[model samples]
Target chain A: MPNNIATVLSRQDTWRGRSQRLPRRTITTGHNNLDLLLQGGWPISVLTELMPQQSGIGELSLLLPTIKYYADNNQLCVWLDPPYQPYAPRLAAADIALDKLLVVRSKNHAEWLWAAEQSIRSGALLLAWTKQPPPRYADLRKLQLAAADNGNAAFLFSAPSAMSAPSPAALRLELQSLEINQLLLNVRKQRGVAGGAQLQLSLGEANTQRTNLALLPADRHRTYPVRQFNN
Target chain B: MLKRDIWLYLHFPLLPLEALLPQLPTEQAQKPIAIINLQKNIQRVLCCNTQAAAWGIEPDLSISTALALCPELELLSRQIEQEQQLLQQLALVAYSFSPVVILTDSGSLNHSSVPSNHSSGLWLEISGCYKLFKGYDALLRELDYRLRSQSITAVNGIGQNPLAAKLLCGPDFETQLPDQTEIQRRLLNADLSLLEINRKQQQSFKQLGLNTVGDLLALPRSALSRRFNAELMLTIAQLNNEKPFNAPRFQPANSFRDLIQNPQGIFNKESLLFPMKTLLQHLCQYLMARQCHCREIEWHFEPLIGESQKMQIQLSGSQNNWSTLLMLSRLQLERLELPRSIEQIILYADQFIEAPMGVFNLDLFDNQKTAQQSCELIDSLNARLGIDALSQPILNQDYLPEQASTLATPGKHSNTSLNKKLKAPQPLWLLTDPAPVHLRNKKLYWRQPLTIISGPERLCGNWWQAEQQRDYYLACDSNGARYWLFRETSSQRWFVHGLFS
Candidate 1:
C-alpha cells in the first residue's frame, strides 16, 4: 500500500512536469525568429507584460500577429485603452479578424481593472490587453488568477516610467527601437528561462536601405550585444 | 373520450387596492390605505386595504367617514385606468394556466372611465390542464400560489361555464362547482342577489319572497319568462347549459404598448422604477401568454412640453425573463437624465420570437445556459456603459493601413467584410495619425535616428478621394526597435506608420 501511494504521488508530479504528456498548446507571435527565441511562442494561461520605452513604438505590432491567430480561431481579443487610436487600415492589413477584436474603454484605472478582470474570467475571450498605470500587487495578482482560471493570455502594457515598479506577471519584456527596420527585445523576466536575454530582430524590406543616417542622435546611438539562446 | 369542459373563475374584489399594495413602502404599507374616488360630488372609498377593512372602513364608505373610522387612514385617489390595466394583467396570468381566458367585466368592454363596484373577474377553461397538474387541487394550489406571489388577493371558483364560474366566485358564494348535480344544488342554495340584476329588480324579487335561486326556479318557467326580460331568460338557460353563451376569448397581444400618465411629474430617478416595474411586469405576462420573447424595448417619455424623447434597449437575443430585463433597464435608467419631468411614460415592444425550448430539451452540456448567461452579462455591461463604448475590430478593405481596419459594435459586423482575405503581411499596430520623421543620409529618425535595412514597397491610391503616394519600409531605431516608416514621394517627408512587435 505504501508503494502504491508513492506511485500515485509520482503520477501527480508527472502531471505537472508534463514530460510524458502531450505538449500544452501555445499562441505563436507569427515571427519565426521571436518564436524560436521564446521556445514555441507565448505560453497559454499566463500574464505577459510588454514594457515599452515610449508610446508609438512598434510594441503593439509585436502582439498583433498572435492576436490575429486567436481571432481567426473564433476567440476574442480585447484591447483596453490603447494609447493611440488603432488605425483600422493597418489592422486589416495585418490579417486580423476585425469582428473578433473588442475595444473596451473606461474612465479610470479601477474601471479598467474591473473590465480586464471580468474579460479574463469570462473565458469566452482568448486574449486581453490593458494599458494603464502600474497596478497594485494585489490587482495584478487578481488578474493573473483570473487569466489562469479562464485559460487566457493577458498582456499588460506599462509605461517606461513603471520599469522600477514590481510586477506579478509571468513574463516581462522591454521593447526598444534599434532602427526604423530593426528592434531589440530585452527579456527582463520569464518563469522558467534565465532573464536578461536581448534579441535583435530585422523587420520589413531588405533592399531599399537608402535611409538618412545623419538625422539620428549620435550620443544615443549605442549597440548592445545580442544574447544567444540554446534551445 | 374528451372530458367535459371546466372553467375556473378568479375574482379580485379589491383590485384597486391590491394593485398598489406590492409597491408600497414597508412603513406605509402597514397603515390603512384606501382608494377614494368621487361619486355624485362626494368623495367615497372605492377600495380599502385589509387593515382599513378591519377598522370598518370598507368600500362605498364616505372618505370622511373612513378617515374618522381609522385616524391613520391613508387615502389615495382611485385610478380607473390603473384598475383596467390590472384586470388585463390578471387575464394574462389566467391565460398562462389555460388558453381560453375571458375577462368577465361587462363594463370594461366599453372602456368606461368610471370605476365599477362589481368585482372584476376572469374565466379560465381548465379541464384540459387539470390532469397535467395531477389534479384540480394541485392546480388550484399552484394557481393560488402564483397569484399570491404577484401580491394579488383572489377568490377562486370552478364551474362548467363562464356564468356558473362567475356566480361561484364571490366571497359569499361557493368556491367549487364539482358536477352538474352539485352545481344545481349550489345554484339553488345561492342568494338571488348573486344574479346580474339591478337594485330595483332585486328589491322587487325580495318583495315577492324569492330570496334564493331555488325560490325563483320553483315557479312556472312560462310564468317567470313572462314576468322577466329575455336577458334574464338567457341567463337562466346559460346556468343550465341549455343555451350556448358567446363571450369573447381574450388573446394576448402580439406587441406591448402601455401609456402611464404621471399626473404629478416624477423628478427622482428612483421614483420612476415603480411605474417601470409595473409596466415591465405587464409586458412579461403579455409575452408569457403569447409564448414569445422580446429582444428590444422602447421607452417613450413625454415631458410636460415638447415632443417625447425615446430610449431603446436592444438585447443580443430574445429574453422572456422580467427580472433580467428590469435589471438591464435599471442600469440604463441610472445613467439617463430626464430633461423635463412632465407628462406620461410609454413602454412598447414589437421585436419578439418564439421562446426557446425547455432546459431539458437543450444541449446536454448546458451550452445554451452558458451562452445565455454570457449574453446577459454583455447586455448589462452595454447598459451600464454606452452601447457605442463597446466595439470589436473588423477589417476594412482599404489599402491604407489607417483605413484597413474599423471598430464595429459587436454582433453587427458585416459578414462580407469579415471574409475578406489578406494579401500580404502588415504591421500589427498603426498609429491613429502618422507622425512626420526626418531622413538624413540613408537613415530614418523619429525622436532618435534609425537605420533602414529594408527595401521600399511603394503604394499609391485614392485618386477619387484624397490622393496619396508613399514608399514604405521597415527600419530600426538606435535602441534596437523596429518601425514601419514611409516616405511621401511628392514631398520626400518621412513618417512612422507602425511598429514591429
Candidate 2:
C-alpha cells in the first residue's frame, strides 16, 4: 500500500461520519496494584465506582491511587464535592501527590450531576467523582452517555451504601470491613460477570499489596459479584 | 511505550433495558422511569423513547404530568450520587472487556461538547481492547448480557471513534467512515447531523458551504485553525484519533444556603404528605444548625414577580429537624386557604431558640416495638396501595345504624376511640378497618373468609364518613384465618379489617 494513499485515505477515512467505534483500547487505572487486578489500569473511558472505606477498609483510599494514576497519565482527575475535604494528608500514605487531584463540588445534586456529566463526557481524566447518591435512572444514564461520548472514563461514588437497586451501571461494588481488618468487597451486582463473593483480605500497608486472602462464596459461582444483602 | 490510542463508542437504548431491570416491581420499573433534571425544585424529564412510550408518557413531561400518565410508576428520587454510582458500575463492567473505556451520555454523545450547550454523555473509548477482552464481538456480547440484568436498553454500535460509534448506534441513519480505503471500506456512512451538530452551528456550516468534516478536511489545517477555533480542529483531531485534552471550565467556590419552603396550599391531606415530608425534613435540619426555636409563620406566595422564584412557600418556621415542624406544617396545612393556583411556598419562624427538648427516656420498648410495627405496616401499605385505599370504621353515639360508622384515615384521626373505659393495652396488630361478613343466623361467625387476624378490640373516628362502634371480636376462619370481627351497635353489620402477620 502506498504511504501517501494510506495517510490521506486514513485521514479521509476518519472524516466526519455519524458513527465511529474503536475496536480496542488500553485500560489504565491510575494505580499499579489495581491495574494488576484489572489486567490493565483503568481502561480509557470506562467507569469505576469506588465504595467508601470504613475503619481501615479505605474505600476512598483507592480514589487516590486512581487519581494519581490519571495525573501521571496527564489526564485531569476531578472531585466534585465540598472541595475542602481531600486526602491531602492521606495522599502521602498512599504515595500520591495532592496536585494531581481536581476538586469540584456543586451547590446541589442537580449541579453535581450536571458537573459530573460534563466532566465525564470530556474524556480528560484518570477519574472524577462526587460524594452523592445516584438515586435516579436519568442521572446514571446521562453520566453513562457522557462517558460514552467523551471516550473518557467516569467514576461516581455515593456515600453510605447507595448501590442498593440495580442501576445503569457496569460494575456495582459494596466494600466493607470484616473482622480483624479484613476487607469484604461484595461485587453486589455487576453487568457482565458474576461478582457475588467476599474478597477477604488484610492490607499490610508496609508491603503495599493486597495478598490473596480467600475467594469466599463457595456455594454460588460467577465472575462478577452478585451477592446482595447481608443475612 | 505509551502505545497507540484507539477510541470506541457503544450505544444502548434507554428503553430495551426493561427486560433486564432487576426485580423492580412490574408496576414500578416498567412504568416510565424519567431521570429528571431538577432545577430550582422543578424537575424536567430528560430522556424519552419507545420504552417510555409504553408507559404513555412523553419526554419533556413534568414529573406530575408523568405521574398523571402512569400513576403506578415507581419513582426513585433524583440523587446524582446514586446515578453516578450506577454509571460508574456500567463503565467498570465495560472496563473488564475494553482497556480504554470513555464514558458518554447519550444526550450529548453525538453532540459537540466543545461548542454545544455543554451536554453530557458516556462516550467510552475502548481502544486496544482486542487482546484484553478477546474481540469487539465478545465485548459487545458481554456488555449486552450485563446491561440486561440491570434492566438497561443498549444500542450497540462499533465504529472507529466514540463520536462515530455513538452515531452508528442508530439504524435510522446509515453509518460509515467518510473517506474510502480498505480500512474505511468496512465503515458505514453517516450524516454529519448525527454528530448532534448544533442547529445554530449546522446552519452556520451550511451557509459556509462546509457540509462535513470531509469538506473541512479539504481546507488547509493551518487556514482552518485560523478561520475557526480548536473546536472544529479538536473534533477533526478526535476523528483521526489525535488526542484532544479537554480542559474543563473553572467552577467558583462558596456554598450553603439556609431556608425553607412553606406548606400552605396543601389542601388534599394525602397528596400533600410527600412534599410536606421532604420540606419538613429540610426545615428541621436548618433549625438544628442555627440552634433556634420556631414559633411564628411566614409564606412566600407563588407566581412571583419572577415565576421561577418558587411558588407560594410556607415561609415561617424553625428550619430544624424536629417533630414540631411536622406538626406545625400539618396545622398550617389544616388552616391554609388555597389560592386560585397555588405555587411555591416558604416558611419562617417568628421566634425560635436552642430549645432542644430533652429526650424522654421510655421503658416501654416491648409495647413500642409492636406499635412501631403497626405504623410501619400502615406506611408500607400506603406506599403500595395508595393512601386512598386505607380506611377503618369509627362509631358515634347515634343509635341509628346508618350513622354509626366512619373511615379511619391513616396519619390523621389520631384519636381512635374517645371512650376511656374501652382503653386497654391491645395488641399493636389491631385492625384499623373492618370488612362485611355473612352471618349464619344474625350471629357473627367466620365460616368462610379470605384472611383471619387479630383485633376484636373496638374503635371510632370522625363520624362524618360512617359510624358504628361496638365490642370487637378476634376470630379465625375456616381456612386457618385470623381477623378482627365487630358488630355495629344498631345496624348489626359485621365487619372485619386486618390481618396480623
Candidate 3:
C-alpha cells in the first residue's frame, strides 16, 4: 500500500478507535418560576415522583409551563399513560403545540420496557413518559448510561396510590390537594439533598390577579399546598 | 499473468482427523483413520494418510472393504449437515480477517506470495487480505490464533493453485512447501494419463506412445480436442486453474439483544431520568411493529449468572414511555441492591391501557387544538403528580354556573352539568356550601360594601325545607362587582355564593 493511503487509514483507525464524545448537559425545566422552585428543575439525574390530587387540584396546570418549555426547546415530552385526553384544544388553550408532544400508548407490560429502552436510546428525545413501575437494576443502569451517554431526560408517570417499587431516581415526590384551589406538593425523598418543607402557593387566577381568598389558611388546612425547595 | 489475477483457493477441515483420533477406540490415533461421508449408503472417499495403514484402509475404498480389511474398524454415521454448519461458522470467523475470504471446494489452499506458519491451518492470499488487515502476516497470525482459541485444529497450506498446495502440504510433504518447478513437473507428468480414456481409445493412445500427464500435454491443443472428448480438455483445465468453483451460499438467523451496563439507573435513582435516548428510539421501533402500547412497564435485571430482580409499578393511567415508567420505578427502586454488573434488562410495561379514545380524523381545519393542548397539559401534571391533582369544576344540581365553577376532575361531565340552574354564563368564582355571615340590619359588608345597586332578584326554591323562606338578590358592590347573595328569613342569615359582573 502507498504510504499516504496507509497513513490516512492509520489515522482513521485511530480516530474511530476512540469515538468522539458528546458533552453531557444538566437538565433544566424551562419555566424560570417553576425551575427556581425546584431543585435544579426536578433533579436532572433522578426520578421525581408525581402525586396527583385525588380530589381534583392543580396538578396538570402546574406542570404545563415546564412541559411547554421542553416541547419548545426541541425536547420530546412523552406521556406514556395519562388518565385524561391531553385535549389538544385545552392544551392549545394553554398555548402548547400538539406537535411537540409525542403521545405514546403502551399496550402491555413488556412493551412498556421496550418503549422505555427505545426512547432512552434515541439520544435526541428530551423526555419519555411511562406508567410502568420503576426499572430493575439493569435497565436503570442502562438509563443512567443513557443519561451519561446522551444528554436527554426521561420521566415515569404513575398513580399516587400505586405501590412502591425500587427507585433509580435522585428524588421522590408525593402530592396532594390541600383545598379547592390549593395543591400540596411534597418531596417524599431526595437523593442528593434533604428536602422537606412546605412552600405555599395558590392557583394563579386566569386574569393574572392574586386570589388569596381561594387559599385556605396555612394553620387551618391540614395538608398545605407546598413546594419542597430545600430538597 | 497479472499477480492480482492469481486466485488462491483455501479450505480447512473443521474436525481435524488428528483431534478425533484419541477419542476413538484403542490407540487408533496411529491407524490410518480417514473420516468418509456416506450418501445413500455409498461411502465416498474423503481424507486419509499413512496412519490408516495399520488398519489396512485406504482412500476410495468402500466401508465394507475397509471393515473386511480391519475387523476392529469403527463405523460412524456421516453428518454432512453438521459439518457444513461448522465450516460456515469457521468461514464467518475467517471473514473477519478479510472481506475477500472465499470458500474453496478443492479442500486446499494457495498463499505462495506470503510466508505463514505451517501449523497455523490458515492460508492467506496476501494481496487482498493485506488491505483489510494491517499486514498479510498479521492476518495469518490472527486467523491462526482465533481458530486455535476456538479449539479447531487443521493443517495450514499456502500455494498458487488448488492442486499444487493440496498435493504439497499433506503429511507426505514433511511440513514444507513444494517447489514450483517440482509441482509443475509432477502435474504435467500426470497429464499423460488422460490418453487412457475408453478401452479402445486407451489401446490407441498406448500405440501412439501417450502414457503420462506430460505425454498427454505434449500433444498440440487442436489435435487433442479433435481426437479426444471434452472431458479430456476439462481435466487439464482444472489442473491448470482454468476452471471455476462455485462456493456454498449461506444465511444466518436474526436475533435482538441489548447490553445494559447499569440497570440501576431506572431503579435506584429517583427523579426519573434517562441518560440515553438512543436506546429508547431503538425500543420504540421494535415495539412499533407489534401494534401495541405499554401501559405499565417494569424492569427486571439479571447480572451475568445471577438471579433476576424486577421492580413493578401500577399507574392510574398507563403510558408508553421510558421516563414515566422509569420515574415511577425510580421512587420505588431506591432501596434495591443491584448486582455487580447487569448483563440484561427485562422491561415490563404490564399496565396495558389501550390507546386513548379521540378523533383520529377530525376536520383538519376544525382548529379545536385547545382541547388537545389541555389534554397534554393534564397528562404531564398527572405524570409528575397523581391523577386527582387536576380538575375543572362542575356545578351541582342547583342550575347555577357559579356552583359549576367548583373544581371537578377536568373532563368528566357529571350530573353537575345537567343542572337547570347553570343555563347562563356564570361569574368565574363560586363558593361551595355557602358560609353564613350575620347581616346587621340587612346591610352586609361582604367583599367591599355591595352599594346595594341591584335589587333582590327573587326566585325561591327549597322552600319545603322547614328551615327558611329564602329571598335572593343580585347586589352590585360600589366596585361594579355584582354579588349573588341569599337570605334565610327564619335564621335571618345572609350568604354570598357567586357574582354577576
Q: What DockQ does each listed candidate score?
A: 0.30, 0.01, 0.05
Residue-level lDDT tens digits of model 3 in B174-286: 22334557656655555333232458767767788887656766778789889878865765555566774333322221222222334233332321234223234333333
Candidate 2 structure quality by residue, lDDT tens digits, A56-80 = 2344444444455554444445555
Taken over the whole model, the C-alpha lDDT of each candidate is: 0.70, 0.45, 0.46
Instruction: Say which candidate scores most in lDDT.
Output: 1
True contacts kept of 3: 0.00
Can you write out model 1's per-residue Cα lDDT over B34-123, one digit (the tens) per residue? Answer: 988788888888888778889998878897788788998999887666777778877888888888888865422324534545557778
Residue range A76-158, candidate 3, lDDT tens digits: 45555454334332344444544455445555555455545554444323233444454465655555555434334555544
For residues B1-501, could you state the per-residue lDDT of candidate 2 as single tens digits? 554333445444343232123324345554556555554457656555455678887645678988888785545434444344345445545554544555553332333433112122344455566555576556556666766665555555545555555555553222232232422333334455655545776776677787555565567789768766666667767666565534221111112122222223433455545545544554444444344545433444343234432222222222344454454345445435445433344444445545544413443554433333333333332333234434433334433222333334443333323332223221112232345778665545544543323344555544553544565665554423234456666587776543311
